[model samples]
Target: MKVFKIVRVLFFISFFSFAQNEDYVKENYNKTETTITMRDGIKLFTVIYAPKDTSKEYPILLQRTPYSCQPYGEDAFRTKIAPNEFLMKEGNIVVYQDVRGRWMSEGVYDNMRAYIPNKKGKQIDEASDTYDSIDWLVKNIPNNNGNVGIWGISYPGFYATYSLLDSHPALKAVSPQASIGDFFFDDFHHNGAYLLSYWRVTPLFGHEKTQPTAKPWFNFPDLGTEDQYQFFLDAGPLSNLDAYYKEDNVFWQQLKDHPNYDDFWKSRGIIQHLKNVKPAVMFVGGFFDAEDLYGPFNSYQAVEKNSSNYNTIVFGPWSHGDWARNSERQSIGNVYFGDSISHTYQKNIETTFFNNFLKNNTQVTVKLPEAYMFDTGLNQWEQYEQWPPKNTEKKSYFLQNNQRLNTHAEKSFTFEEFVSDPKKPVPYSEDIKMVFTPRKYMTDDQRFAARRPDVLVFETPILTEDITMAGPILAKLKVSTTGTDADWVVKVIDVFPSDAADFPETQAYLKMDNYFMMVRSEVMRGRFRNSFSIPEAFIPNEKTAVSIKLQDVNHTFKKGHKIQVQVQSTWFPLIDLNPQTFVPNIFEAKATDFKKQTHRVYNDSSIEFTVLKKK
Candidate 1:
């Protein structure tokens, strides 16, 4: 045991050291700082790390981000540059830039800046900014091959996607990993429902800086207690947040102004503009990504539909940005996957992708699959010729009386009733502590929620055979609410066998005994069932059909594992509490709007799973 522990420690030490060694980056590359002027005469701060070898020219890899390109001075060096250490070793001229109006850049910052299709005079947007930046880098930067590639993880990923639109001639390849294509469906809002958990970042992007500074002008509110469920509940209606945010926060004000998806959000969506993509594009996302899952999937689909570009997608069983940062891809929270899964992806997929396009390396002949995804249940990587592979068949599981899920529809009319109270909303996870971003809740055990009177649980008989589900999940629910307005939260979970044992690595913190792991879930504002642009009231007790589209899932329920569905009106703190009463603007809803109401989900309702039938 002692010898094993020593070997394990040494393995990780060696793994990370080789992957992200600060000494290695500095020794091989020379760092230079420059301020590149945009089309509108706005100067943006940028950092360039060029290979010391003057014998050969290297391709320029750029990442534009709202997040600061830190270690400002030319003398100071970042811990590492490029997405992986292999790229640094391959000797590329990597660049990092602070977008206009952010961190030493002279301009104004617009949150998810609306793309300007037709620009006259000195007009500029993220796409134009990218063009100007790329054009400047290839021309001015020393010892740079004309070829350029752009990539970034989260917000930076958004910028990378923007680059694909009206791409520069020099831009050869681009990867947008966990990038948000639309704000309404991606980050702050999911299907027109506000993600209350992200309210913590109100100060991060909300505040307007008078000058280009290295540090954030504002600080996040320090919640006295770690229990966000209690904290948000005590705060009352969503309007209560105005007390802290005030009027100066433009982004928060925009949320209030745009109660419904309208021209404002439509203009900000980058997916529609992904037409005529010139560069070879790779869209990356995590299946369990709490944030921005909609972005990568939708962006890839849009490109595939509209543009004739070489596009592919990669999704792993990882949390937001986990594939890029985590060395231990073996598990997320209590769930244990195979070891070095992330390392394998980085070494095999990401590195090879860049080398083929940017470096023009013909030796790397590996053709990446069109859809390279990790099956969560099988815990292995699978490649498909097309996403939502042509082989899948749509299967419907009907919700029945007595907490049951069956393939056949129930002939008799029956319903499960739950009283939803805004004051005492359902907690998203069993854990009491507040997470700034509720990530683990994506795969959290649903036992606590199953026991809740307000949450309705429906389950299938233990699967006799492995049921593999791929692609999108649709929840067509026939629901009626006593109140005029409400929010419908649907969760698809995998129930572990009763005799299941915990893995050795997670024995201390996890127990698999009848564990209910959430596979895919989504929320829909009841008012927006018909249309997101306009909201309609429920008309009290009238039955309404709400179609809630859960994000794409590639999970398999192994034999003996039961597939479960959980339905609830409120997923508090994770999503802002719906007042229950109809309000034109939920952000401006009054305290009186918060009330207890009974919600009924009929047996006729069904969940559609894209099942991959075995040969």
Candidate 2:
């Protein structure tokens, strides 16, 4: 029997002794500050925090940020040190520097996407700037133990990843939280789907257009932070994304140049270069994180598989901003965690990883295993040697009942036919406020959407026993749209409680990729559903089989939560409106080109879900 003691939800974790000790390091004024010039002749603004009594040497913790390195910020009010903490203020020195092209740093700020690296006969990159910055910090900073480590969240997180590239030996550990791997795949290009709305919105949202010329840049409404947004009504470079900004944007042009996985995407691709990691690092991500779930997870997996370096992965049920700002206890809707788990994981787990490797010179694997995940259904955290558990069996459930799926015994039924209008795509919700968001309803009451003539819904009856599934989910459907090209958005939803009487609290939605969504896995352009690397026009009304793969999904269907699978021809606003007319590039297709089309799903061994379930 295991005897586990309860840990209070609230507790303090002081990083370094000096931060708490007033006499050790004066938290008041500039203990030390300077701007160092890199070997490339670009000046980097740097600030150094040192102990008041510098009679002895201490380990250094380094952070490189593009978000302006404010020399004297509110962070001073907090103590940096405590035993079992990351910012053990007592260490050698803490360093912060502004990345090139940001803040006071010299060099024209070319967004990271325009990274010009000095590869063999290739353009030079910010990687060298990172290399140069670290090199200068180590040699110049005083009261230094000479040991250094780097860390940053989000964009700075990107800088943190590059710090190790052509890195110095003295560099120790790093933690990249919600960091982006490649702008193409994870950021604007989700599963190869051109996230046009988010892409254009992000640049403006981040004030990227202001660049080096627009000094004292202003912050606008974050894309999703606004109270309400009429995306088309807003007048700006971003509002007319498909019109004014489509091919004109520099990065957009670059992305188009590399359509269909080519050298362009491969250049900034960090996965291949992860080998020979100099620092013991930790990549953090939220399972529900919309921004960069793939960044930390993929980064961790790539490094572990491609190289001999050891790293750790921490995955929790969190959205983009959940892990930090919200109550670590729980967040949005009715999803309440039993405890302040986020708090513990953030302070203890994150700080521990940094301090242990950078300061203590200890191994990270000993304290906790390489991978740790919190399971929502069980309300507990579990440790595993690897992801997708070693012993996972693949399973499948067929689509029937006029596209209805049920465990209460189901039988094959005739295929369904519906006419889809490109102009009036089925909105995901009944309310007009969310008309642009057509996919949200896929997670909600399938009943409302199934009534639509254009949608196909397959549902399973309430389960008698919990059906546990772990790993990615896939949908192999034999589908044919009347038009030459169209989009198909699939969603796997968990219907905890039926809407017949009351709404259930527990629910999760996983959106599938259009052929565009499949770039992360596979692509099924409507013209080539039954074929590959070639285009095949829909024989007007000919029936064909096409496999649609929903990305891997993990969930356990408790005795009550019904499993729902929804299929639609369009996921507007989330995806560009398919013109329903085969064209060279739908992004530029004229309005007149769009047409009303009839789509038919075949049933002769046509549609099935390769789902995983318990024996």
Index of the highest-TM-score prediction? 1
Candidate 2, residue 514: Cα displacement in angstroms equals 28
lDDT of 1 by residue, 1-615 (tens): 242232223212112223556677688889888899998899999889998998988999898887678767887777777877677787899899988888788899998998888787899999899999988998898888789989888788999999988789999889999999999999899999999988977766787887888766666676788888898989888888888898888888989999899999999999988888888889999988898899999999999998887788999988877776545546666787777777788888998888888777423367899999999998999999999988999999999999999999978999999999877788898678766567777888888889999999999998999999999999999999898998999999999998977876443656888989999999999999999999999988888899999889999999999999999998988999888888889898899878899999999999999999787
Full-model lDDT for every candidate: 0.86, 0.54
Write one digit per residue (lDDT tens) for candidate 2, span 422-457: 656665433344221122222334455556878776
Clashing residue pair totals per candidate (backbone < 3 A): 0, 24
Name the 10 consecutive residues with the lowest summed lDDT in model 2.
3-12
CA deviation > 4 Å runs, candidate 2:
1-33, 49-59, 70-94, 114-123, 199-202, 205-249, 252-262, 326-328, 406-414, 427-451, 498-554, 603-615
Which residue pairs collide in model 1, if any? none
Model 1 score (lDDT): 0.86
Worst 10 contiguous positions by lDDT, candidate 1: 7-16
